[model samples]
Target: MSKTYDVIVVGARVAGSSLAYWLAREGYEVLLVDRGTFPSDTLSTNNLYSNSLGLLRGMGVLDALLNTNTPIYRRAHINFDGAVIDGLFPESDGITGCLCVRRKYLDQILFENAKAQPGVTAIEGFRVTALIQEDGIITCIEGKRKDGGDDIETYSARLVVGADGRLSKVREWAGSERKIAVPTDFASYAAYVTDFVQEGEMHVEFYKNQDKLAIVFPTSDDQFVVGVMYPLDDSAWMERFKSDPEEGIRRLIDEGFGHTSLADRFRKANFAETVKGMHGYDNDWFVGMGQGWALLGDALSFKDPAVGQGLHDALYGAHMLSEILSQYPASEWKRSWEPMGKVYQSAMEAKLMSRFWIGCQFTKNTPAPPEITAAYSLVGSDRQATETFLGMYNYVKEPEDLQKEIGRLLSGVNPQIPQK
Candidate 1:
């Protein structure tokens, strides 16, 4: 007989493992399965903001994360078409800062915490191929051990979750339809580097250019993550990097920063990890809930990393679903899964879809218009506006609110409203 569980989550990285951990605390019997092992690296510029840190703190995983000694970045610099904005991430409610820890370290921490729970049974190296349905309802998953042998096995669950990411197998098998999907017009390349010097060790810098955008983040273990997003259709750029990524990335760095004093600093930096990139994926949101199964994290939505929102959005997805699921404990979840799943799905769409749209727009790689740059400079000059603008990523500060505040600041001055 196949083993049974209250829930079975596929893809035990950020979203899967964290959801298992959260659900386990709610007294659910969870079977968490992943095709890969823990401490494995995945594709991400996986930075977490204050709101995500607050969620982790609430989940009791913050201290363990902090123990890894990832540097907490309090200040930031955003350069838009040569206009600079400098500010601090606001500290409130004990959520003090941001960090871009390596995914291997971060995922391992969440996975370890999850599998340790008595209510959770975590399995690694298991490739789930298909779902088993009875009377048209998904009841079990079937797959084989990735390394032990070819023998296939099965595990049953009251509900199955697809946290498997962009090309989610579970999402495919479940036939979750897309509601709003936008193809990414730009491609991203990122790497971790050593000896990448900066004035402030606690600063993250973003440089937005006409045809590309470049970002430099100070990350854990005394390393920096430098990334660039270029127009995907640019054939010359693709040809230049397709074979020798190192030379290409180095050239990109040399060119991106060549105009600034920082150019010499990056020229001396060495790679801590090889450059990795993403291409041909859509920044989209899928229907969040379905019968007998639900989607979480990148399985449900994937946005351009340009906004640095993907990691936090995944954590937020887990937290949001868990919040709704908490209302109906494991014992009663079977009866409530569909209805509450709809509620959760609707809530996810309402809360996050707008941001995904914004991320889609960012792929255009156009420089910020002059008026917007001026407004940014205005906002950056004001400490309060700057902090609140930083808080926009955390969702604590709404876009409309920021616009209003900017208007208030511009009220007294003769604002240069651009004409058609």
Candidate 2:
């Protein structure tokens, strides 16, 4: 006889742990499993927009997060072809943006919060190998323990969620076909630089040279996270930065840009930890998965960080799924998943995907068309337009709706639109 749970979630990272936390709090017999222990390391930019503030408050972890990390209120900075554009910070008071500690602290805090919840059994060092299903319904999972023991655990849940990341095992077991998949193209190198902290830290800085983009994010511990994104294929990246990561960063800043004052400061900053990796991938949505199981977060698909929407999308998805699972009957789980899927997918298409395409076009060194530049400039300058952009940037509004609204505004200024 095997133990059973009402819900079993794999991957105790951000998405998994958050889901388990909510599900367990809702009085469900939830089993949470992870390949690594809590407070583990993860690859991320180590920043969160203010939009997540509301969700954190609802989860009752907002105060903990704020106490644990720094608060960011500065907008992003874009450095293009020797020109700089300053945007407003994300949050405005309680409605403003925030940056909690980096992913290490953030994930650990979330894991601890989830572990403290009742009816939640968190098992670490368990590598889930496969799903155990009977008559087309998943009943249990099979895997090997860290101690070289073969363990078979049966968790007969009414609903199972695949919160595992890009290489998701739950998604695989659920038999969901990849509807849209793209290889990751952008790789990011981020690190904690100590002793160079600034108040109201700037969020992101985009350089005209695609080969170099620098971002400075504040951590809860008064440290700064400086990140650089570039093409992974360039072997010189390691050759250049490996000698002295700090110096390499400085050289990149000075050479990539036409020698800006901020770049000088970034080059001279004292960094704590220097790390690098690629940032790529487009909207990935799976299809044909059975009704009982659903995929959420990066498990379903992930877009590039160029838009800064991945985690927000993941958190939002978890919240949405929680609503559906708690409200709907077990039999109607599939139907419930579909509407949310469509809504989420539409969001990806409209916001992330569309923005990615537009960004790709503009980020190219070639001179942008007058119409394109004017449109972007219009949105960049107008307060309401900025609000719309900020809303989308923080995942507050659907991309499709924002697109329509922006189009309406743009049309008022420049008409002769096309209808097909």
Candidate 3:
């Protein structure tokens, strides 16, 4: 006989562990499975926005996080060519601000919390092999038991959640269509390197060059992460970046936007580690199940890291899903999921999708308009604008609405800074 659970969550990373933690506390028998053990390394920015922090606070993990050396992000510095735009971001409403921490620490904290919760059984170092369906409904998830001996085991559940990541096997078993790139919408690459920090305030720098855009986020311990996204069709350069990152990276930095000061800092700084060749899939970015199963975090939708909203979206999604499950009936899970889906879908369309499109729009030789430069700069100077941008950055509200409001604010006002 197979063991039964109220919920079976595959991919006990951030999304799965969060859901299992919440659901298990609600008196449900939950099974959380992951392909690796705790404290394992994962490729991620590890920056948690205010929106995500708020959700984590409710989960009782915020206090523990504070005990660490996570840095707070209160501003953003954007550069286009040699022109610089600086902005200050106020803590969003209901949340103080965002923080950056290492992934190993963050995931292990979440995993341990879930495991300690009553009725939550965490099965780490187990790979979920398949999803079992019966009568058009997902009945169980099958995986190999590797605790002592390798053997196939199954955990049945009334509801199955696919918290698996991009290219998830569970997504495949759920019958998701293959992802296709939108026309003229290409892919890009990034690499995360830890070491060195931006002085003064915690922030993300959006480098808007003539032909490329790179994002850099500064974290605690004098460490920062840098990612450069370029056209996918540029295979020769891409291949070089993948094959020999140090050589390729140095070359790009030398030719960078004429900003030798920043590039010099990167050169002199000690590299903690390198996560190279990080790529993004334009479509199949987000997928969700309609009935009997649901998806959360990257399993549902993934956006380019250019926006730095993945951690925020994942934590907020878990919060929204938790609220729905608590207030609604088990049979009504799908209905509850729909509204949450709509919320996340709208968020993606605004925060990331639009930004992705905007990034793609400027990949050509077109000069970035003065208005865009001012907009980025004003966010640092104006508290209200900073708050709005941070709110969107944290996934607290719809970014589309925030952008519209920012547009209105900028229409009548003259930029205090001269555009280069």
Residues 277-336, model 2: lDDT tens digits? 543545565752354676777786666555555666667666666655677565565456
If the candidates were sorted by their lDDT against the true structure, best first, what order would they fall in? Answer: 1, 3, 2
> Candidate 1: where is the Cα deviation over 4 Å?
329-338, 413-420
Superposing every Cα of model 1 onto the true structure, what RMSD results?
3.6
RMSD of each: 3.6, 4.9, 4.7
Q: Write the per-residue lDDT of candidate 1 for residues 1-420, one digit (tens) a residue.
A: 389988899989989988998888888899999999979998788788888888778777788888776888888888876767788887755787897888988999999988998899988999998998887778899987777687888999988999999899998888888887788777788888898778764688887767777888887788888888777898877877787776777777577667664567878899887789876678777887776788999999999887888888788898788778788766676577678978898888778876787788787656567898899888877777787788787777878878876986887543355434
Give the clashing residue pairs of candidate 3, or none: 87-380, 88-380, 285-302, 286-300, 286-301, 287-300
Name the TM-score of candidate 2: 0.82
Cα shift from native, residue 393, model 1 (Å): 1.5
Candidates in descending TM-score order: 1, 3, 2
TM-score of each: 0.94, 0.82, 0.83
Residue-level error in angstroms, candidate 3, position 418: 26
